[model samples]
Target: MNIRQMIKENNRLQDAMTPDNLSYYQDMVVYIRSSAVQERQCEELLLEMARRLLDAQDKGKDAKDVFGNDLESYCKEQIERLPKRKGLSALQYHLMIPWIALTWFFFVQAIVGFVTMWAGGPVERMTQVRISTLILIAGGAYVLIHVLMKWMKSDAFKPEAAQRKISARNIGVYVAITVLILVAGVWLGRHLPVLVIAPWVSLFIFLIGLTGTKLLFSTK
Candidate 1:
């Protein structure tokens, strides 16, 4: 049958089935949708599977009997049998491991830094800061090495296309901001007690580390 015909049949079955059967069919639809099948193929397969499931329900069989004990696994096997489509290469996943590890390391550093600043004695705080810094540096080096390795070996690791040009006015604004921050930092360093500045600096570092880590690990 055509895709539309199959879909209509499935929907009719869905309407006719009991709530429990309907729920199982809905989950099957979700699994099929999420499988690595091509869009057109997925639609056809989903409807086909739904129709079969409905047939089994009509015969008084449970979902497990219709789709086997593991419906998702069955659907995945079927999807894999379809013709190959474009997907992420193994290199992409290999590169992601180091990146994700680095992101998690920085996240942990941020948490440790904050906790140490709030709870530790002077010596303990200094020690924690040093340890966190070392961890951050090590994690960064590991990620950089993996990134460089991928860049050397794979075209897929190359940087994306350039974004919009920064206008002359934006450059001037950025310079002004940099100068303002430097001036503020110097002023604060000279006027504020170390104890007062230290906690804020720690907090600022924690926030930046957390944000950078989150951005690095965020999925498209």
Candidate 2:
């Protein structure tokens, strides 16, 4: 019998074994022992009965391997039933490959923004050239490394690893949201007189957007 059927039979056997129903219990036990159920099934049913007795006596411990092995076996059966596909079957890895590529591109753009903002001051002509050159080199290296890695590696999206990396990206999104708020606050301060720091006003608005996104995307 399949596992599920075996479980059902076990449940029926258990219901018949209650101490308050001694006659019924004895009859059920006799029926089970005399039945044509396989020796293995009989042994499993007895083991389950012993486990329950132990639990009732507050001496039972968990059976780690049994459940886990059953699940693993079940999963293997399901996989065998699926249509065959080429290469690694991890979907998260494939998805993260593109994400990693996109993140690298955006990271380069952010660096460029920093370089421009730092170099554009009126007093530092030499600083502009130095900073801009460094930004360009850094951005170029980032793109080159990403391309090379993608070309060389086969499976880029391992979900377990990608989950951690995506958490870091979420943190970065928070930082970006903070910066935008600061900019808006500065703009507001320049235009309107306020009791609180003018920058904070814009910051509040920025925080709202960030908080909204976090709420919308949060899974749990």
Candidate 3:
């Protein structure tokens, strides 16, 4: 199965677990999935682990007894055993992320065009977003998302310290990043050309993106 299919299957199996068991299972899921291990390997391990836990639960087994107390060590051992991708191998074939992102971006622009037309504006002048501004926006979005995801996964295994409150410092950092991105985007947008994308072109790009995802998201 593909990574997405395995992930869906794993999640479905986890629903059968007792609340306590599900919590324990989620710890393993978030940690390994957030790790540098290949996505396919993580899904495979999680799928097998979910099935094992369900079986153990049926026999009135305690999760701690079966998996032991050291969640970190157990997960690390499994990560080590799985095949590791070296250098570019780890970086390749993960095009679904960008493909889906761009698809949604264009799809939204097309929707905006529809909104403008309903208001009796020219569809050709739907958006005034410049190429450089788009790049800055996309880049900023990626960095912000990466930071947030890291914070989310950092304490996955440490359930005791799982509940995190955003402090003033964190808030300040986020605000600063937002301000910087806005400043850069505005400057670039003024200097660069406002290449207005026709709604039809955006729709076409969205269609192309759909085909790109089929080739990227699957190994076949």
Per-residue lDDT over 26-130 for candidate 2, one digit per residue giving the tens place of the 0 to 100 score = 333343333345445554654464355435434333322222323234333433444432333355434334334433434444455446556763323222222
Model 2 compared with the native: what TM-score? Answer: 0.20
Q: Is candidate 2 or candidate 3 better by lDDT?
A: 3
Residues 1-220 of candidate 3 have per-residue lDDT tens digits of: 8988887788799879999899888988888877777778888989888888888999999678678998878988989888764323334333344446668788888889878878898766676557875677467666777678866676566655434444445578899999998898878877888787777788888888878777656543
For every model shown, what is its TM-score relative to the native structure?
Answer: 0.37, 0.20, 0.67
RMSD of each: 19.1, 20.4, 4.7
Q: Show where candidate 2 strays beyond 4 Å.
A: 1-59, 65-71, 74-96, 119-220
Model 1: residues >4 Å from true position, as ranges?
A: 1-12, 88-220
Residue pair clashes in candidate 1: none
Give the whole-model CA lDDT for all candidates, comma-separated: 0.57, 0.42, 0.76
Order of quality (lDDT): 3, 1, 2
Ranking by TM-score: 3, 1, 2
- The 10-residue segment of model 2 with minimum total lDDT is 123-132
Cα lDDT for residue 41, model 2? 56
Candidate 1: residue 65 Cα off by (Å): 2.0
After the best TM-score superposition of candidate 2, give how far the Cα of residue 138 lies from its true spot, in angstroms.
16
